[model samples]
Target: MLHADLDSFYASVEQRDNPRLLGRPVLVGGGVVLAASYEAKASGVRTPMNVQQALRLCPHAVVVPPRMHAYSAASKAVFEIFRDTTPEVEGISIDEAFLDVGGLWRIAGSPVEIAQRLRARVRAEVGLPISVGIARTKFLAKVASAVSKPDGLLEVPPEGELQFLHPLPVERLWGVGAVTARALHERGIRRIGELAELGEGPLAAAVGPAAGRHLYALSRAQDPRRVDTGRRRRSIGAQRALGRRVRADDEIEAYAHGLADRLGRRLRAARRVCRTVVLRMRFDDFTRATRSHTLPEPTDRDAVLLHAVRTLLTAALPLIHERGLTLIGLSLTNLDDADSMQLTLPLEARADSTLDSTLDALRDRFGSDAVTRAALLHRGTGLTVPMLPD
Candidate 1:
């Protein structure tokens, strides 16, 4: 079964520990509302809101900075409980995870019972509240968790997956985002229940051929997505908001190449070779789009990923060519867990591994973006990476 998530995690922790902060509006992160307590939410403070604006919404709200180490320590304790319950655990993110315990019903008890114990353990040990959603499929379980948020547990029986899923809004599906929803809405398809009426052909035409069929299948709760254990992510990548909109293609290419290089470097450091490149772009309006391509061969090299990223830039560059842009991210996928680099290829990309190693050393010594290529010379500290201030 799958578990959903925690509601207002950071703020919940802060409120649980401090008696005075309990029942009062609380906002984490003085710079931005990283997490806002339910009280703060009721008062109009929201996550990602600027502190000043949030303060205006709730003058009496308690504002605090994020304590990553404290949260990390708490998360570790929570994961320990998860491990104790099941062996197959998949970390969805820092805040949530999934556990596959298909046959543990006898020892671990029923899904509902296990969820109750797990939630209780998390609250008792880590002092943070969590909501659990149990279901036959990972997707449904995640949906269930959203339904039973704020220290609650919800279970969708095997036969009820479709009943629970189909009536909800289309935005609940994994890949359905704002743009896709808008496209569906344009066709008078608003609810997941209504999607069944379109039939697959009409639905496909509405939201692109690729996404429409998949979404139609999902509307009927027909997901075959496995809880993959070998999902040893090939790369760890991050994107920074440029703060201001950027429209030029050259600037976007240079920025994307830098990010690709960073992802490739991280993949190499972990001794993993990725055969596919995934590029994720978040437009100014908070909507995200992704494109990916499989390389001819596996590589942990910077230039290979950069070439694909640049190619993707040519495709998506047109959209942002005249418009404002906000965030861009790149990641490498199809990872070969073992670095089985066969040096037998007749045509090889330039062996710039040495140069990458040198640049990485420099960046480690000084800071990231410290040793950039000539192409990146004018991209002066574009979007900043978060750093500990002196």
Candidate 2:
């Protein structure tokens, strides 16, 4: 198993395209820090941090707005290389993927050799630094890649997996977040070796049963999952982060409508229909909430989706008013191919279908801005972030 991950993907792309940003601290996005170069990270700048706070941490950092199209193109090019390397590539995100090269020992020399070649290819062809980790299990491979970051490579052989893993911190184990780390710290279990010696029963007592089993297994380097490429995305979604501000109900509703509109178009473009519409919100206090409504029938129509979105948003308005929202997100879930949808006879429904098809056609031929909703005319459409295929 090999896990290959691009280092500082967005920031790397920016630095690669512009020579001036090569060795400088580059921060992507305006309101929030989306990606930060290693130079910026050295100054304590982090992703999702407020840009102002990041600037305060790294005063000389160069802030750049996110270029989603460029990032998408880079992702496509890199994935092409991954597929060319191995047919068994499981993409974890736009910047990382797990590959199984077990069967290529005779043809490709060894796993370490394959990883070295993969990293070299990415740097030479894509002009970006990538880290590659080789191990017998997927979990160890992922952990190895994370440990050897920013253009580095490491291999954990089966004979020495424990020697490599046991000395690491307990936080290195998956699912050991800040809360879990504090709980384990209180128990005097700070290392993976310590946690493994604590026994599964005691670990379960410390954390919940399921998480305990998960962390305990990872502590022993016992992941058995393979790199699977057959899986498809369960949901398609989009969200916009609104800076700290008091937005009126109408403005919020407009944002919801805009999200629904974009998602509906995406669903149709992907030839998928969704059975559920979910509204996700983040309040100013950093708390998150979600409300979902499953429709009687799957749909890709903008009107149907917008209506469901508005209904969910309206129901959550009282809570939003009380908490003050900082973000709005919409997701269409329970997706199935559009060809599976049954045809209906209502004339109004047929008219709506025609309108949807016409608008999609216009947008595909000309541009997304070819048609617009009256409500969204003056209110600018929020940024369209790049996403993996649905």
Candidate 3:
């Protein structure tokens, strides 16, 4: 197994396109640090951080807006390389993927040679740096690639797996988040080797049973997970962060309508239909609530999905008022490919479906702004944050 991940994906793209930005601290996205160059990171600037704080850390960092389309194109190009390298490819995110080369020794040489060639090809063809990790399992390969960053390559042979992993900090283990790391610290378990020595009982008492067992196995490099290429996304959804300001009912409803329309378009584009509509909300207090309604029949139609989402939102209105809503999200789940579904639509339902298809066609040809629901005609269409494919 091999894991291939781009080095500072967004920032690297910015540098690749402009000669002046090379070897400088470049920060992408002012509102949030979407990606920071290695130069910026050395000054303690990190991604998903506030731009103000990042500027304070790296005073001379150059900030740029995010280019989602460019990133999407780069991702497609990288995945094409991945597919060319191996038939079994598992995409982890936009900039990272796992390639299983278990049976390619005869044709592609050893895993190490394969990884070196893959890195060279990406740097040459894409004009971007990629780091790769070769290992016996997917989990270890991912960890290895993360450790070997910014145009580096590393491999862990089967015999040296524990030697490579046990010396690392406990935080490097898969499930050790901040809270878990703090707990491990309190127990004087700073390294993976130390955690492994404590046995499962003590680990379970420290964290819950399931998490402890999981951490214990990973600490000893006992991950049994394979490179899965058939993993399908269980849900498709979109969300908007509304911040702390209070919003009127009409405004919130408009956001809901826009999200439903966007989700409907995505569903149709993927040629899939969903039976369950879920409304996810986050309050000002940072608490979250979810409400779901399963439709009688699956649909990718805008009217059906919008109605179900509106119903869920209406049912949750009292809680939203009490908690002071800050974020609204909608997910369509219980998915089935459109080809597999046979819907019996009534005359009125068929008319609505026809209108939906027509509007989708117009948007695809002209642009997303070509058509808008009457409710969102005046207010600008709510922002649709492009999500990395699952």
What's the lDDT for all of these models?
A: 0.76, 0.90, 0.88
Q: Which candidate leads the pack in TM-score?
A: 2
Better of 2 and 3 by TM-score: 2
The candidate that wins on lDDT is 2
Worst 10 residues of 3 by lDDT: 343-352
> For each predicted model, how many residue pairs clash, with residues at least 3 apart or on different chains?
0, 0, 0
- Residue-wise C-alpha lDDT for candidate 1, range 64-147, written one tens digit per residue: 777665666666777888888887887776678888878788888888888888888888888888989898888888889998
Give all TM-scores, in the order shown.
0.69, 0.94, 0.92
Worst 10 residues of 1 by lDDT: 381-390
Model 2 Cα lDDT, one tens digit per residue, 218-308: 9999998998898778999988877688998888888888888889889988888999999999999999999999998989888899889
Angstrom error of the Cα, residue 270, model 1: value is: 3.8
Task: Give the lDDT of residue 359 in candidate 1.
Answer: 78
Q: Which stretches of candidate 1 lie over 4 Å from their true place?
A: 241-269, 273-339, 343-390
Query: Could you tell me the TM-score of candidate 2?
Result: 0.94
lDDT (Cα) of model 2: 0.90
Clashing pairs in 1: none
